[model samples]
Target: MRYAGIAWTDAGYRVEVLDGAGRRVVEPSSWGAAQVSELIAWLVELAQEHPLAAVLDSTNGLLDGPMTAAGLAVCRADPWLLPPRPRFGSVPAHRLAEQALRTPGELARVTAEGGTLTGRAEEYFEGVRRSEPIQAALTAAGRCFEHGRRDTPQVALTFDDGPDPVYTRRILETLDRYGVRATFFCVGHHVAALPDEVRRIVAAGHEVGNHSWSHPFLPDLTPDQLREQIDRTGEAVARVTGEAPTWFRPPYGALTPEVLATLEGHPTTMTMWDVDSRDWSRPGPERIAATVLESAGPGSVVLLHEGAGDRGQTVRALPTIIEGLLERGLEPVTVGELSAAPSDRTESSRQPAPAERP
Candidate 1:
């Protein structure tokens, strides 16, 4: 899937095609917000022919409605996730921070540039369901788990869907620098591409878990594909660490009955988070830190990202998260360690259940 970094060009628009890594793909060109809907429509039709994730800058009340109309799903994305992204062309060059950079009429503009073509787009674009009914089935089967028992005062920190060459190493270094050992749930393809990082992670005495081969929504894949996703990811992790990862976190936390049944005896635990950093949205470094720190406790598993877009916000928040948690008297441990510790079982009893995707 190709991502684009777009900017407003004095009178119109400009964009630079980017790889998922936020690497430049093409020379910048004028393609302002006005063209976003058409592009979204084109992408929607194209997805029927090929798999593509539409990552866009659609701020200021633009694009998402059109995307929803074009049969493409809409999830909030943080510009921080894609650093050095194309800013609105009108933004001042002196601005050092990306989030601080903005267009002149963001909140002030109340009218849509193009009149609603809702009926036309709806004829074609259809929204996907939040999740399959299988989630409830898995919950009933007792296969879905929001977290482990919080017996002790130590909380486990698990980083997901990464092993990226840049952020992963920085996170590992931060953990090592703090003398904290956390778990990293890695993707198979990423592990293959950066096996050295995997070795470095294990060498640092941090735990590694499987996060599937392709990061697909397990319920969307056929049973065979799901099995391959689980098995292949474990193999890749084991190939580097000499032992299969003992945990599995479903991509997007979209676990289903088939998912649990497929790995019934695979020695992997289905892990989910009670607190989401929302770093992927790049709210701010301070807010990210606060979210993790505020929700942390004896058995809290804070959902933080090390990969999938730029995680610099996560990096920025790391030291604060560590320091704050420590000050609050919480120790960061791995998920495996969290489950293994005999839980008072009551530490998290009064806490609200994690709002994991069901």
Candidate 2:
């Protein structure tokens, strides 16, 4: 196996390939961004002899489409996880190669397993995942709480990218059967397409949250774009439900300084989750149930998705998850009901905004 690290600056990109033994196989080379085709051709030729895993900084997400299209396995190495680089130097491309070769679990992938960060990478992402905007916004005013009050015996099961005609309705039925209320973070466009579905969520007494307009990576949007995404979704949800959302969860948990600043004074609690079910992967009903039951406890904000894909697995796991939480004497409730300070949510802790790897 070969590990190829691709790093870029405003000027261009640099590529370095190394074997398992840490010996350079492909000498370090630089390529202009426009030379992506040439770069892909070079990598394709090399891959004929050795299986190559192309590792890139999260900032170089633009290259993911081209690299993966060329049949190279693509992995992301986040700058937040790397050791501080020299002020005048970029993160060493060779270091990325070594990390990919060492504990590959630390890196997220565009293709392969391992949903949440594992091993040392987990700790690094957890420590640095909070966007600058979250910190600044919370420092000045309101709070960004991942979980509610730990002392409470309540847990919040929050769903993102939802109001789907199929899964959302099924999830609502399951919740209705269980007599439980959860939060749904919905996208704007989805709301418009399925206003009745979103209305059902509110009519059933579940909390609705703004999940951006089209669910794009929040950090990538310009300030105006960010505001529009938020406002549009908020308005759409309010239009359908006859009530504006009081909570906001950035899509993919991706937030930026601009996002926080723009949302500052928006009168919505910036809600995140402490426990990620990783149900998006549709691991299995049992696996999903166990994942939630294992980490979920008092005041836990559990992440689940009801829309944007075939969520039959998540729907299957719903009953077991609810039963397990009940058996443990923890009541599942909405984010608003679980958090004592929902109106003035305040916390400085955050997880790094993970790259949108598909």
Candidate 3:
């Protein structure tokens, strides 16, 4: 029997289909609205090829109506309920504990900061525990990440929107001087133009990841457009680095359904940040440093930028951020190293994604 599993993940609404061999694979979206008259029309066409059932983890199984309308069967199943999810891969246990145990004041502060992290984590993992297929889809897609460990001092420092001819080099030099490892998510166009910068980032023992092609808001693009953004970026980075990035950050962290449809089989995890430096706003280095040092703990992903602006202050603040983190007994690692399981974690420990990939 052919079946599909659907869950909204760090990506958009994630849809996985069981192929003829009963192997779960990413479902190619036929609802592109290009040639299709309606989503139901497309789903109906899909049904004619084979009998299909949908297994959903969310009580909000938002896809149920469309599936049933398309003449497909709907079944409530929790592929993530018992084993894999919330525990599988590298879960930021210490981070989740911090979130789940937020004090009233802290909760109010997070709310004021527009953070929905705690609620999202609580709901997603609860479903992951009961649904095997849903868990598989998320896991295979590299949806796992870690924050700081409860007993140890390990965190990640991630910089995005870079390969700026000047600023990136400065950041690299600083990181090298301090013998620190950080993760850089580079844009495709920038990578192509400055393969040298990308190489420099990789050569310095830092992790490199795809940050998309032109830095478009992904949700606004079609499936084909999104795929181009991802594939071409991966190709550009792979051409210079010899290995395709196993990590991805949506441009401006804008992940929506149309956006994630293109990432089905890609061998990359979605990386997110736990701490916000707000450096992109041109916040002074002092505020940036204070934000990270005060909010960071065992499993935090500190977000900063390099190419999106002058980045001089960020360069200046780099040493202070590192030193302060150290004084707090926190060890900084790359996003790849920080993720507990797939080790390609994004540590989406913070709230809403920034403008695009952060």
Model 3, span 1-358: residue lDDT tens: 4555444322223345665554544444422211212444554666677765544432221234334434455554322332233211111222212222232123211121222121244543443345445435654655734354555577789988777778899999998887899989887756776788888998888888878765554544556656666777788888998888878886545444334446554567766666879776556888888888888888788888876345787888899999988888888888766665432234444444222222
In terms of lDDT, the poorest run of 10 residues in model 1 is 107-116
lDDT of 1: 0.59
| Model 2 lDDT tens row, 309-342 | 5578899999999999999999998887676553
lDDT of 1 at 282: 65
lDDT: which candidate is best? Answer: 2
Clashes of 3: 27
Quality of model 2 by C-alpha lDDT:
0.73
lDDT of 1 at 302: 82
Model 1's C-alpha root-mean-square deviation from the true structure amounts to 14.6
Q: What is the lDDT for 150 in model 2?
A: 78
**What is the Å distance of residue 149 in model 2 from its true position?**
1.3
Q: TM-scores for all candidates?
A: 0.59, 0.61, 0.56
Rank the candidate models, highest lDDT first: 2, 1, 3
The candidate scoring highest on TM-score is: 2
